[model samples]
Target: MLLMMAEVLAFSRVSEALPNSTFWQFLSFHQSHVEWVGCSLHDLIQPSFSFLVGVALPFSLGSRLAKGATFGALLRHTMVRSLILILLGIFLRSMHSEQTYFTFEDTLSQIGLGYTFLFLLGFYSPRVQLIALVLILVGYWAAFALFPLPGAGFNYTLAGVTPDWQYNLQGFAAHWNKNTNFAWDFDRWFLNLFPRESTFTNNGGGYSTLSFIPTLGTMILGLFAGKTLKDNVAPNQKIKKFVITGVLLLIGGLVLHLTGVNPIVKRIWTPAWVLFSGGWCFLFLAFFYGVIDVANYKRWSFFLMVIGMNSIAAYVIADGLGAFIGNSLAIHLGQDYNLLFGLPYATLVKGALVLLIEWWILYWMYKNKIFIKI
Candidate 1:
């Protein structure tokens, strides 16, 4: 429920489905991505999901390690899992027909990279992880700042094909990471530079080695958070620490933006964005953690847990089954309802219908204990 609300309602494909109506225009804010170079409530959905994965890492891996899991076991597990995720991301990036699918802009690939980094961070302590986080964020900032684009300073100088931040980098990525579940070669040899391959798309590029830097910060922050939750400290103490940390991150990010060291770009996952987004993640989860674990208010979290439990499944289902039924099927069924509402109210009602239908699918999965982990 919490996760799904974050994903489905987190975006506006549904709103796009009803452009002719004022109602949709009003609700459009909820369903769309941030305009560009700024933040919005909708923008946090993907990073928050990744951050949640980070929060779960300590509990899951620590449990196995406590039971005598070996270092090799952990590494092998992490590698295999990341490979599977890379494949899954490749799959999602290719989900639609060739006409609809492009080389980048898939969320699963981002999640795959995030999980892989989180796996490695699990081997380190919070203090050490914090140092690495700073290095990754600052290191990438400097790297891009020094690396020249064809026609620009420091930023990627992608060909004029698109006005995106990284034109050359994404195409540079597309040449090798084009999707065979593995691309055969850097056949364009001149384009290959970075170890990881990512394609450029108008929406955004996934698989960017550059984006990984701040995203790594997101994971470290999550690890720090996960460790804090394990402490047997008092509730007020926990709240105070998280609140202070969140405030500091928020304040620090704002101050840095003012200095212009970072501009808080979401598409590129800038350092400022990482700090800002992670701070919100900390603040948001702190409240939830305080209530559920600290105050023993487990019942209230149940609604969110419903959506959270089957989160990945819900994402897959939404990607797969959602359009057919809630869209075309509903249109067919609406021979009756459509007569009453027309396109205006009907479109709004359709969004509600789609959401309810998606929730029910989640409800069904929950009842059956059919949780799918990536």
Candidate 2:
């Protein structure tokens, strides 16, 4: 959550302050996923967030079931929550627009698109969920592999690829190329079904609405992890399972990419990307669970808890309130003050102040026990 909040502001500041700086470049690498392959902190945000939703499902369902909630009631709640998330995503993306963007590629919208399916999976056994996960990945892969690859004469430059781009994969791999894929094509039509000021051509980032299909695989991985955590196994045994599972996922994802079967591209949320990101999510969960849940080291986690407890509010504020808060700071502190210490340092100060204020708001909400759950 902190990473997502600070990412754009911090990276832009550093890059603007020190153009062509290798340090900023490396930091930006961590802040954004590579276009074709590799993982990073920023890329992991959506996956981890979606995965955690899956992680929480068992507990949520269990709590409701314990309270004698009916399946019908649960389904109704699921629909409402999903709708809320989708609408909120659209609202956030349309903040500075005249009309709704109607985009489904945002993290909230992507999650919302698949949330119902995931909720349904919560009732199934782990074995069944694993099968569903496999099916999703394989099915998505088939869609790509079965699609016709762009011909050799096809223009790459128009699609943002260098004419001499060497990373271009051959055979079925070309079907999964950035802008010229089944998913991207489907999006060109699907997104156009909504009101638009202009005809939809392509997502500049190469993201597609259909990426949610493979994203389901990431959530299913979380379902497995949540099941493990909810099991009657010992703490040490659970930790071992998590670590092992995480390692296997990482290996599986990399093997696919390295063998030229699939490239781990997050923009389209490819199957390999799902496994790779899901692996990191599991490892992250393992670390936090090991220290706090297993070792009972709770003192150092208070700060994190404040943000975690009201994550929805934190996310909304980060996305929608950033500009307002920045401008407010500029007014109070004077724009020149930020540049007094140098543009780079000023950028850092402004970002830090914004984050601090955001944290304080979250902290206040936490203290008041006002968690805004979707």
Candidate 3:
């Protein structure tokens, strides 16, 4: 979560601010997903965030159940949390805007949209959860696959996509093409139900509300991982399960993409992407669990634990108050103050300062035991 937050609130902006060089350019690329084919580190952030929410759910559910909370109470709590996440997502996207954004493609809204289902799955056995995951991935894949593909002579230029965008796969694959998919069509109808600055068209990034379907699968993978962690197994056995499952999922996703059965597109949240990103999430959980909980190497993780512990606060403040902090710094310190090596570096300095401020806020919260939960 800290790494993902840093990418959004720090590295991406810094990459743009730094002078154009091989290393910086590479950093920039890693900070953004490939146009239509492959994933990037930045692309994993949302999925990772969603997956971690699932990973944490087992623990949360266990606590509530142990406290004698009824299933009805749990369901109600889940609904309320889902509502807050959706509303918070919309509110955050509307930041600095004149009206409510009503966009459900943001990470918060996407998670919110699928969170209740995830919570429901948390009560089920691992076998049921696995079946649910398969059903979600397959059902979502079928939705796009069965959607009629754009006919021949369809003008890509007219669709606002690149004239020669990659992976214009024919037949079923074409049904998932950028800006021309079923999800995009649904967004036109769905988003238009609310107020808008203009008629809802396409998300500039090729994302859609329907990505939540596959995102649920990502969370399910985490749900399974969480179950594995919570089960009464040896630490080594649990870690082994995580690593092995992660590797298998990674290979499975890669094979699907390579064989052209599914294209690994992050924007549309393809089934392949769910497996791919979920694999990475598993690996990440394994690494962290092994290092901190298993090996007891706790001291080095203190800084990260601060941000991780108060992720929502960090995320909301970074997106909501980040620009204000940067502007304040520029106003008081002078715009030229951030110009370390050159004018191009100004944004880098300002972004770094903003990140520092965000970290300090998280740190303060951590010290005060003020963790904010949805």
Return the TM-score for each candidate structure: 0.79, 0.95, 0.94
Q: Please give the RMSD of candidate 2 to the true structure.
A: 1.9
lDDT, model 2: 0.85
lDDT of candidate 2 over 1-374, digit per residue (tens):
87888853577567767887998877867877676667778888889999998898898999999999999999999999999998998899888888888889888988889999999988988888989998999999988888877677876654656545665556656777878888987987899999987777778888889988888788888888888888899999998888988898899999988888988888888899898888899899999999999999999999888888988998999998888899998898887866766767777778888988999999988888899998
Please tell me which predicted candidate would have the highest lDDT against the true structure: 2
Reference-based lDDT, each prediction: 0.63, 0.85, 0.84
Candidate 2 residue runs with Cα over 4 Å from true position: 19-23, 152-171
Residues 95-194, candidate 1, lDDT per residue (tens digit)? 6645333232345656565666678878877777888888888776665555433344512233213434332233222221111101111112312432
Looking at model 3, which ten-residue stretch has the lowest summed lDDT? 3-12
Tell me how far the alpha carbon of residue 150 in candidate 2 is from the true structure, in angstroms, after superposition.
1.8
> Clashing residue pairs, candidate 3?
none
Off by over 4 Å in 3: 7-20, 152-158, 166-172
Tens digit of per-residue lDDT, candidate 3, span 1-374:
55554553344555666656677777777767777878888788888998888889999999989999999999999999999999999999898678888899889889999999998888778889889988988898888887776667766554667645665666456677898887887887998999988877778889899898899999888888888888999999999999999999899999988887788899999999999888898898899999999999999999888888888998898778777888898899986888776765566677778888889888888889999998
Name the candidate, 1 or 3, with the larger TM-score value. 3
Error of 3 at 33 (Å): 2.6
Count of steric clashes across candidates, in order: 7, 0, 0
